[model samples]
Target: MQQMITLITNSISKDLPATLEKSLKKEISSLGPVIARAITPIIEKCSASAVADSIQKVVGDRVVNQLDKSVSAKLEATVARQIQMQFHTSVKQTLQDALRASLEAFLVPAFEQSCKTMFEQVDSAFQKGMSEHTVAIQQQVEATHTPLAQTLKDTISSASSITQNLTAELLDGHRKLLALLASGNAKAHSTNVLQPNNVPVTGPPEVEAPLDPMKELGRLISERKFDEAFTMALQRSDVSIVSWLCSQVDLRALCSMVPVPLNQGVLLALLQQLAVDIATDTPRKIQWMTDVAMAINPTDPVIAMHVKPIFEQVYNALLHLRSLPTTSPSDSTSIRLFMHVINSVLLSYK
Candidate 1:
């Protein structure tokens, strides 16, 4: 019985634990179904939320960083380009302003004053000297008139040789007067002296004026009073005044000193006036125009305006002359020759 009890006791111990374990497993299995049903969705929800937060942080940081870098780079590049452009513009403007100021300060006024002084001095001296010389010549001529006439009559009565000699003497005196007048020494009392009807005075007479306007103009040009000289030339209406101005000026030299484009208008006007003089049948005028045209840029509008018409006129005149017979030269031939020379000279320019 005791041995049977021991075996039963040992078997009971093993069987009892096994049985309890089985019961426990069955109860846990039942509870697992409930737990799975209830807690599975909650756990999934929590895990999903955590994952979404992590992704949001990562993507937000990456996007934000990229945008910041792009914005910063673009702003920096824009600012640098703008600064460079502004700096370049400012430098160019400053340089132009400085150059303009320098020109205004030095050149214009000095030239004007020098011309005024030169004109005044020359005009005064020429008039004073001319007047004194005129008075002296008049007095000498009057004193010798009666005696000279009587001697001439007496000589003519005696011999044919004496009359011829007396005539020659009178002719020599007349020639002297013409010389004085041609030299601009004789008083231009009337514009009529230029006419064939008016007799000229033949004596050393002092002119009343102190200055010769022509000489004054020449002096101004030589001294480089270009602006003033040009102004004076334009103001004077006298053909002689214009002629003198054209004669004195060195057109090439004047053009060289003058700046282009800026002074082109003034220079062109001067050229136009010169062309008028040339067409007036003055060879010196033609020569002056040729010199001026050569000195200026060919593309210059003023030069083109002045020269193109002259070229056409001369070319047409030549064609007309060619059609005529080759006979003794007339005034028309002279005109044709002058035009031909003008055409040749103008073509040589530039």
Candidate 2:
């Protein structure tokens, strides 16, 4: 039976293609039935029980072998044709499609998951690169901005300092001018006489006249007549002379005279001069002015009369100086002297 099977396989191999070729290529439809009939004899040779088994074994083996060979030949021919057409067409696309379909079937959800993971990885890398680029740009901007900000701050600081210094100088100039005006007014308005105490009774041909009011005050101070000197200094409303005398006199003794009702105009004039002077000569003069101004009874008509005019004069002077486009050297010097006087008076009060 094995021999018969082998023989039938070989015969079928040889005749089947011939029958199919005749039917398919030559247009001979009768060859298929003829081939079927030829195989029937081999089927009959086996016994009824053995026929089915024998025919099944033999025909199955022959059919399987033929199918495999035909499929393999067709595949080879298709591959050869594809290789030839590959240069003319996009073969990679075809291969990719075929691979994708096959992998999809075999890998199922795992394949889909792998594709998603790959895409995420690529996206993450792109985002990381963009973030790094952004950071670099920001750092560059900060590098430029930091210096610019610092430069602007420095410029503002310098400008502010200049403004402050100029304002101070202008204020000082105004006070000096006002004090000079006040001094001139005082000299014109005052009826006080100038007397010298330390002069010699007899003099040479070239002998100078007696010391002026300022010199006499100095002599009195040197002689330790501080009270008399201070009183004498206050008598003359010369802001410059009075200011100098106050500086030389003992402040403790000077303060004791504050409560006494003297000429308030003279006192206020003295204070105004001191205010201007202290602002320049000594910064602490403002405090002194505050103290002395406070010490004076605000209700006193005399104090008010004196304070009001001086305050108005000083205020007007400051406004005038501030409004002026330019200041002269003489005006500048006068302002300095006034400031010195104001400083000394205020210091005495403090």
lDDT value for candidate 2? 0.54
Candidate 2 residue 281 Cα shift, in angstroms, is 0.8
lDDT per residue, candidate 2, 1-350, as tens digits? 99999988988899888887776866546676787798787766656659777777879888889999999999999998988789347777787888999887788778788899999999999999999999999999999999998988886676556545544553444344333333433432221212122322222121232358777777777787653454456434344666676566545345447454333444454455554434254433443444345444434443333444454444444334433335455554554454454345444433
The TM-scores of all predictions, comma-separated, are 0.26, 0.28
**What's the CA RMSD for each of the models?**
31.6, 25.7
How far in Å is the alpha carbon of 54 misplaced in model 1? 99
Query: What's model 1's TM-score?
Result: 0.26
TM-score of 2: 0.28
lDDT of 1 at 341: 55
- Candidate 1, position 184, lDDT: 45
lDDT of 1 at 280: 48
Residue 190 of model 2: what lDDT? 23
Which ranges in model 1 have alpha carbons more than 4 Å from their true place?
1-219, 252-262, 275-281, 301-350
lDDT of each: 0.55, 0.54
